[model samples]
Target: MRGDVLVVHETEKPPESWAAAVLLTEHPDPSADAPPWQEEAIRLLRDRWAGPGRLVVFAGGRRGFPSAAPEHAEGWASDWRGTALAHSDVVICRSPGGGCPAGVAGWGAGHDSGRIVLRVPARPAAGERPEPGGPEVADAVTAALAHLGTGAERTGVQRQVPLPIWRTDSFQRWYGAQRAAGNTLLAARPVWSLRIGADRRLVFYWALHAVVHVTAEDRVKDNEVVISRPDIATAVLYVPGATIDDTEIVLVREFRTAASTPDGFVHELPGGSSMRTTDPRSLVACEVREETGLHLDPGRFRAHGSRQLTAPMSAHHAHLFSAEITPEELEVIRGLADVPQGVAAESERTWPEIATFRRIRTERLVDWATLGLIVQALTDRGHPLP
Candidate 1:
């Protein structure tokens, strides 16, 4: 992995400055009674910083001087002096407890400083463990070099693609034209559907479930649509006393891949697309039961209201509802688990264990998913806004 280097400045140079590099290399055959710290330090350097460097081992009273053979010590160097030396624009000294001489003669060789000494904790601590890869060490080095004014910082930008929408009639016409044109525009045929609204507005949503390869100047090419504006529906469920505590709400966390969204894990409320049912209240109940094992009665939960979100490239109409649920109901919902089946079988063959469950307080309800719907339901019932 690529990373930056760190440089340190010192006012005065110590006696020994001739060593080009000081590396921690493992002993050919370390004794069982060897000091644990020495062994650990050598291990850390070898495992984490094995890239483009040489190893140097100091001699001890009993161990004598390290066997710096011609092949091993040809390009390697070390100082027995305790004095500080400058390398790669940074100062370094022999660590404490080594058998090297106190001060020794060394030259200021023009050497590139590509190595760093890391202080590792002697014992393991809570929430702390040895890093698995060298990238982490590279990151640390880069950060240190940046702080020392010897490294440059990098910047990156991400773009999101917007979903497309059209009228049902216009979409059908476009689909027929493309089909008659020998389907040359798209690699695979596009799937078109009619999304009708209660207000008599017919929206045509095209979903190309199959992948399509398009040759265009713009990098942001449109992918197949999984959910259309008309097919997209949202419902909010409310429990009267649920918000009393600060950690009651249980939001589902999953990985979602949609236009204008990250491909990482996301937290969302239980909801579905293309709801054919007329009763929004019943839809909320069914969704809650299906996604989260919580059985909610339609009569107990009432539709607060509906909101329509429209942008230049995407539109979604959501229906929000609220219902009261007991602590026992919350427990059941938290415990209910399922292993993904069918197409998702390989992805989640083993059921995911619940990571955590918390009841959120009324004042903190804003942190929960579908906060707008929850607020709407509460406000409709004369609940004062926070």
Candidate 2:
């Protein structure tokens, strides 16, 4: 639950300035009953900020903060929802123009008004104590730590591990951050932790569920809850050079702020979660273009494979595909820097924050699990591997 520690000064420094007057949160409608945690979170936030800026709070809309602030407090609006959540927060920057800093770490970004709106991540309290041992939960937690690699359970901010071309640093940082936050209700591979429950019942972000069965007697049999995600579309696209062995991968490298990494961008397949549950095949075309500007005919993609990720803690499945990148498309992707996922404003984008980094070598750092699938796709298609 970290933030940028925004300090607005009225031509001078004051002890009470950091205390925000208005606590802003999202609501589909202003009249809807507020979330149960809203009031409690505000109370906690007030204590942390420590100044009686304003007693009144509002719960709706994100873009109206300028008009909503009181005259006494000309600039007093910030989002502090992370404090109530169990996980540590990471920073994200939004870029609308060719050069916007809204998305870089340790840097301020400019908005349309040429003003910087910095939303910095809050660093988690380091060295959280180990959980009390329970035979069942302890066993599960131990196994998860092993799969996640060393220092995953170590406190006081674990050091960064060298990212494989197959993995993103964001995931690694997130894993450590989750452990630092110490909310390990359910743990397993793929999904080291379950942030939210089924249909978002337990939390408001991720979907966690269990295999359930209802018998004729009306008695229910419930299995452990696991993570669920929108149907995903995965593709291992590559451009074939003049020589048969000159195949270069069509990959994307993007910064994921959730990992709290300045350089955690990973070599990833050009894919994304579904916008709908229908044929995921339709997603490849849009995702590839938005992610890397690599246009592809979805119809040309062949079904490479599918697999369940994090079998124990998640029912999340990824549908994998393989397609050949045309020479014209490769030219477009080859000339670019990485994309960074930023604010709520640009998050709804098809490519959100992604950049093209087509692969000429497997030696480039990659996200392992994803790279494994990509290699499989190539192997199935008889594409030569280095």
Candidate 3:
């Protein structure tokens, strides 16, 4: 069995110093306490260290840290209890004898560091087997460690400004006057692939250094302009009763006077007006519960991609995600008092009644508008969209 290993240094630590090496090992024997899929991982680590050195073996809930001797051969159990067998440099498993575990047969030198950690699954019995690896696994581990050793360089912070657009003849004239005054309006190039309707799409890009002023004509009477600075946001999509075959996606329908369509009703994915401070995934889950009355499993949701929506007057970037939900989860949401608020308003308006969820065929998904585009984008990115 061959598996990949990673060696990472703590970001807070000095660049020259090594923090820890993590080995994801597996056991082969079927009856072994660890799952069979883990065998490939263990073999990969063993092959990497063909020579004699300190190697810790962790099986079950045994302590494996605080070695009696600095360079002694010992093994210990990891402090945390979890099924995932991975370790960070700061905390490692150590054995009671203060040496690497005897279960680790072949060992070698890892990047020099004072602390070492080993993670093992909590199982009933410990299997005693001397599993060795071939040269290929060893080479693969070395290459993996080399790649992890490189640190990501910190880059300067880039600011984003949200420029809101309102429909007004006077504002257009003001823009022209500003242009004549040597103020150039920046427009983001349309992402050709994201274009949907035949109508030409436009973007209003503003710089942080520019001063934005809203004239009386620019404001709709009794309506305030709500412009949020451009920022990263996450959205989680939850579908109830979803499976490999039968899948049902969750959506919401709201009345929008701004929509030019006949019905003036907009079908959208469950999301919300995120203060640029929220993480995309967190926002999605939070919005789902707030708007549609659904409690979603955060772990099941996966981020797909992001898109910039540029209208001549306003612009925003939508972060997309996909998640799975069960019927039981939907029942819980239906009992809640308030659903997530997916849209924002600057003025008083009649709230649309919640539309009962209707299942639309995934193939005919394009029949819907805003959410359809989002689903299409996710599908194109190879994310599961139902």
Candidate 4:
């Protein structure tokens, strides 16, 4: 089996192939003891293999993949390898905000066709779980080979990260809508992805290495790993008053892990990602109700247009809206201040905060992005802040 791809499980004897050896593991924990075969496999790759060959070790995890950490160097796969392959250069596949079983790619030697290890996603798509001899395993191998370039195997595996969204209905819908709007895709490949939601897994955050043709002369290449959850609906909710000073602004204080605040909490307007809904107004309305317990009418929301939240790193856009509430509604929202709220399954904890518009700006309570949304909403409504 000189040029053939060999797939083996635990304690399986090698088929004497030099092209590519894929070692599959049903063991989920990266901290678990490595089986006897793992050390032997690493030793063979380090000692033998003069020319083109590759070794791919694949494992699965239920809570998350070994390579889904914020920093790839700190990923579980980097230190999981036994003493034999301990110092090998590890490449954690970019899964922004982590995944429930992410993947990593590492090379043992200097050459491209060297020993590699991968942690395949236990849940590849919505409502799917990893099974022995499943198609996801094959997809994982294909992705590894693809990432390894032309030297991994001569089996004609395409030299691109396979789009693994075939079973993801939400991704399919988003892709279809994007394409229908004439944003022609030139060449796209998924780098890493994480599924969101408890009831069903959907591609929530994704990283991609892609090239898309936008216009006749505009071919954009994006290698950023921040490629998921592009469209989000947010609003500048307030109660209109005689002057901006008396205007009451509504914000939710929530613990954001990445926040630099002393309490790891950020105070921002009510907003959320466009999940399970296509209408921006509907999405914001639901988010407002869930976050602040203010059940405002969807018709009350006025679209203030949208802007890219982070253009350089991601395609995510903040769909801006503004809603003016009555004094009675303001009193109702104030009654719920400091109340623990948000979707429990998602581990979201928010406290509704009602502050004067002047106080918010004077104290610099919100980030620049939130400030921009406020300015945009006020400007759009012809009540530009002085």
Please list the residue runs of candidate 1 whose C-alpha ends up more than 4 Å from where it truly belongs after superposition. Answer: 1-227, 231-233, 238-247, 259-263, 275-278, 310-313, 337-369
Minimal lDDT window, size 10, model 3: 154-163
- Against the true structure, what is each candidate's TM-score? 0.35, 0.40, 0.33, 0.55
Residues 1-386, model 1: lDDT tens digits: 42211111122121221112232211222223324344333344334433232322331222322333222211123432212222222222223232222232332221111122332222334587633323433443333233223121211100001011222322334334444744423222224333344521233453433222333332323464433344333444433442332323445555555413343544455655432435666766665665666676778766656554332233345666666567677667656655331124223121212221222332232233356554565667665554
lDDT, candidates in the order shown:
0.36, 0.39, 0.36, 0.54
Model 2 regions lying over 4 Å from their true place: 1-225, 241-246, 258-262, 336-364, 384-386
User: How well does candidate 3 score on lDDT at residue 45?
Assistant: 45
If the candidates were sorted by their lDDT against the true structure, best first, what order would they fall in?
Answer: 4, 2, 3, 1
lDDT of 4: 0.54
Better of 1 and 2 by TM-score: 2
Looking at model 4, which ten-residue stretch has the lowest summed lDDT?
Answer: 105-114
lDDT of the structure predicted as candidate 3: 0.36
lDDT of 3 by residue, 1-386 (tens): 22222221111111121222343433222122332323444445444633232232222211222212222111112212221121222122222232344354321221111112232332323575433333433444554334233212111110011111111122334445545755543321111111112321211222122243335345322222322223333443444333322334455555666655446755556665442455777777776765666666666667766664443333355666766556566546544424334434533222212222233443332134354444554465455643
- lDDT tens digits by residue: candidate 4, 160-228: 222233223334544465567666554444545655555223456665554555555566645433254
Q: Cα miss at 372, model 4 (Å)?
A: 0.6
lDDT of 2 at 267: 53
lDDT head-to-head 2 vs 4, winner:
4
Decoy 2 TM-score against native: 0.40
